[model samples]
Target: MHVFLIAALSADGFIAKTVDQISTRWTSKEDAAFFAQKTKEAGVVVMGRTTFETIGRPLPDRKTFVYTTRELLGFPPELVEATQLPPAELLAKLEAEGYTQVAICGGSQVYTKWMQSGLIDKIYLTIEPVFFGTGIRLFTEEITNTIRLKERHLLSDQTTVLEYEVLR
Candidate 1:
């Protein structure tokens, strides 16, 4: 399976102003539409607990896997599942279930975890024309990797999507 991390960030590199801040609040509509299109095409998404909570529901048309130990109560069995497997194991399970591509739609914690796991093959980041001087980062912990630029998509006049191959 091809696993990639996806996130939208402020121009200064923060993902959100606070833990509970919904992405749609700051991200452009074009970014939202782009997100929906890609994740829908992937058919599966994985995210941290906080990210799932902020969204408050399983994303329609895609199975959501929350990477946490907390029992995911109140979510439909078919739409959501809780997982604590390491990045490779989780990817294995999803691939076994017939998903070709997996999107890591995350909060900082999850982003760091997957990046450190060294399994992410690509990263898709939408940079919006906004600045939050201080906020949650794209990754909470220190990580180093060489990513080669693969594509640059101009979603709008002010919003751009950068795609990179996460070279191992």
Candidate 2:
């Protein structure tokens, strides 16, 4: 299955001002609109529990899989809140459910894990024209891999969205 990771970060590569402040407030409206459109077209959206909590709800018309090691109680019926499954296992399940692709949609930890596991096929990153001096980065751990730039688009708000294919 094709798993693409998507995120909007500051020019300095920070996803948010802080871990707890993981919202789209800093990103431009164009970036958010692009994000929503891509996620909607995806077969399913997968994110870490913290990321899911930040979102606060499942996206419409898409199955959202929240990966957590903790015991989640009273989750909304629309979301699939469960413990972390291996990337391959998760992809297999998604494929069996007729999903052609999955979108890894937030938080540094989740992005790092998937990238480290070599599951991300491509990345759609929108770089906003701002700098946070210091904050939560796009990846918590080090990832040393090459990516071929597929294309780039400068949004109406001047945010640049870069699409790259992971070179594996």
Candidate 3:
């Protein structure tokens, strides 16, 4: 299955101002539309518990698999499922369920874990105009890898989307 990490970052390289901050508040509408379109095409999105809680609901027309040890309340199992499965195992399970691709929608730890697994095929980043100065980063820990740029799009006058192929 194709697994890609997608996120919108501030020009300073922060994903959000804080753990509970909603991305829509800082990211452009064009970026929001881009995220919806891509993840919808992927048919499934995987994120951490903090990211899931920040959104407060499962994305429409997609199966959301959240990485969490405890149950997430007030959501159907089909629409939103909590799991502890590692990246590869989860992707394999999703593939068996007929999903050809998966989106690693994030919050630090989740992104780090998937990248560390070396299962990420690509990365899509929307860089917005503003800077948070310091906040939650895309990955909580250090990461070193080479990725060649595959595509770029101007989401707006100030926002740009960069797509890169992982060079493992």
Candidate 4:
């Protein structure tokens, strides 16, 4: 299976102001449409517990999976499938279940964890036109691996979509 990180961020590389706050001001309608289209292409979407909580719930159209050590019995079962395993084991189980593509939707901690684990094959990042100097970063300081840009698509409103391959 192919694992990829899919997120939108400020040009300065921050995903949000905090784990619980999402800055939707910088996000354009075009970006939203594009993201929805791309998200639909994936068979499965996975994220951390924090991200799941931040977003409030799983997206309706796709099969959503959340990684959390805590019990998720209280969450709506129809919208999400919760698991407690680490990234590698989670991916292995998904692959064993015959899932072809998995998208990692995030908050910083989850992004850092998956990136550091070398479980992500590609990343799709939408760079908004603004920057937040005090927000949470996309990756942790421990990630030292280099990523090669495979492609870039410039949108009409100065926003950009970057596709990168995680180099080993």
Q: Estimate each model's TM-score.
A: 0.98, 0.93, 0.98, 0.89
Candidate 4 per-residue lDDT, tens place, 92-133, comes to 887897778888887777788888888888998999887788
- In candidate 3, clashing pairs total 0
Error of 1 at 35 (Å): 0.3
lDDT of 2: 0.85
Q: Please report the TM-score between candidate 3 and the true structure.
A: 0.98
Candidate with better lDDT, 1 vs 3: 1
The runs of at least 3 residues in candidate 4 whose Cα sits more than 4 Å from the true structure, single-residue gaps closed, are 23-25, 74-78
Tell me how far candidate 3 lies from the true structure as C-alpha RMSD in angstroms.
0.8
Q: In model 2, which runs have C-alpha deviations exceeding 4 angstroms? A: none
In model 1, which runs have C-alpha deviations exceeding 4 angstroms? none
Stretch of 10 with least lDDT, candidate 2: 74-83
Root-mean-square deviation of Cα positions for candidate 4 versus the true structure, in angstroms: 1.8
lDDT of 1 by residue, 1-168 (tens): 788899998999999999999999999999999999999999999999999999999999999999888898999989999999988898888889999999999999999999999999999999999999999999878889899999999999999999999998
Off by over 4 Å in 3: none
Clashing pairs for predicted structure model 4, backbone only = none
RMSD of each predicted structure = 0.7, 1.4, 0.8, 1.8
Please list the C-alpha lDDT of all candidates, in the order they appear: 0.93, 0.85, 0.92, 0.80
